[model samples]
Target: MQLVLTVLEIVSPVFILALIGFGWVKAGHEYRIEFVTRLAMTLSIPALIFVALVNAKIEPAALTSLLMAATVGFAAVTAVAFVAVKVFKLEIRTYLAPLIFGNTGNLGLPLAYFAFGDEGLSYAVVVFAVMALWSFTFGVYVTAGGGHPGKVIKEPLVGATLLGGLFLWQGWTLPTFAMNTLDLLGQIAIPVMLITLGVAMARLQVNSMGRAVALSLGKVILCAGIAAVVGQWFDLAPVPFAVLVVQLATPVAVTSYMLAEKYGAQAQEVAGLVVASTFLSVIYLPVLLGLLL
Candidate 1:
């Protein structure tokens, strides 16, 4: 019961804010979801990631486990996606993005912080960083099919991660003014992401919902099951392993639709998957955590 409440309290505001955005659109507000997505990708998300990474304490041993988790987690999802595509004879672009893109940043980061505190969050930061890179690069490539994988290489978020890593490696600290600016911008990322997600969900047609649910279930349940078996085999600790599994089990990322839309790769399908997975995550996540934790 306590765990249920905790999960609800943490995730409910995001859903409610999404509903509010949906209402605005229903009321004929001229707000554009694409603009919000672009703003998040180019500005807010990079700022948040840069700030988090710059201040994050790095531990080689812990980072090793996180890297292991990330590598295994990503491979697991990709493999499952591949099998699903073959089995269902699905269109790769329309289905693959949701299967591979988990909500690592907006949802996973805070959940890690809540469950594991500073140390765990630091581990999550590394995993999140890698996942972000993967999402922007290979994930984009998959969504685009053959349209120029090079384009994904040039995304601002990719550049930001590189720059942030260089700064951390050199032990460089941003000036107070710059840090404050980044902090302010970072604060906008989560809310904007949630609202943009809501607006996008509002635009999804009812007909898309069934397909979305089927895809999301495959991504969450199947991928998480894979992670669980791998986690036990590798002997990951209960809390950290559970954190990793929960992170993996999160819905299709909101960014997947953005990338799909940008690349003209089954955008409606991707958007539907994002909405379906996010809504279902509210039920799935707590149950997964309850069993794992």
Candidate 2:
């Protein structure tokens, strides 16, 4: 009973904020999703990443181990997802990337912050960064057939991650006023993202519920299982291990649907994935958190 409430406390805000966006969109209001997403990705999210990394209290060695774990974990997921795609005779370009890459940014960060506090957020950002790097490069390649990996350098999030890592390594700190301003910008990321998630959910048009559900279930199991095994192999501490599993097990990213649309690889099918996976997360995340806690 106490555990249920604890899990509720952690996840309620996330769902509620998403619900607000869902409701807002349903009420005939307008939301410029592209604009908001651009703003968050280009500005606020980078600030958040930079600030989180710069101020993280984790040791260099622990973070290094976590990085190795995350890299190996994602690689394992990719291999497994590829096999599943081929076995099911699914469209490789349409399904593989989405299965391999979860919604680590939109859903993972806030859950980590709420569930484990600052320390969790710190660890969460590392995993998020790793996923982002992979998603921008290999994930894009798989989805689009060919992509400019060099263009990844121009991404604000990538820049922030690199800069933040430099600062973290050098033991650098920003001035009080500067840090405060960046922190303020970082603070805008979570609520906006949550509401945006809800808005996206309300607007998504699912094409096939059965396939989506089955695929989503497979993705969650594969990702979480691989992450758990990798975390254990790396001897990660409890919180980082949990963070790794949760991040890897997040719902299919909305970006996956967007990428499918952009690449002409069956947008509606990917939309089904985004919606079905997100809905699945609403049930599984809380249950997973209950056990993890």
Please list the C-alpha lDDT of all candidates, in the order they appear: 0.74, 0.92
Give the range of the ten consecutive residues with the poorest summed lDDT in model 2: 203-212
Model 2 regions more than 4 Å off: none
**CA shift of 249, model 2, Å:** 0.3
The residue-by-residue lDDT of candidate 1 on 57-149, one tens digit each, is 764454567568778878878887888898999888767767887887767766666566555655665667667767766776788765455
Judge candidate 1 at residue 28 and give its lDDT: 89
* TM-score of each model, paired residue for residue: 0.84, 0.98
Q: Please state the error at residue 7 of candidate 2 in Å.
A: 0.5
**TM-score winner:** 2
Error of 1 at 16 (Å): 2.4
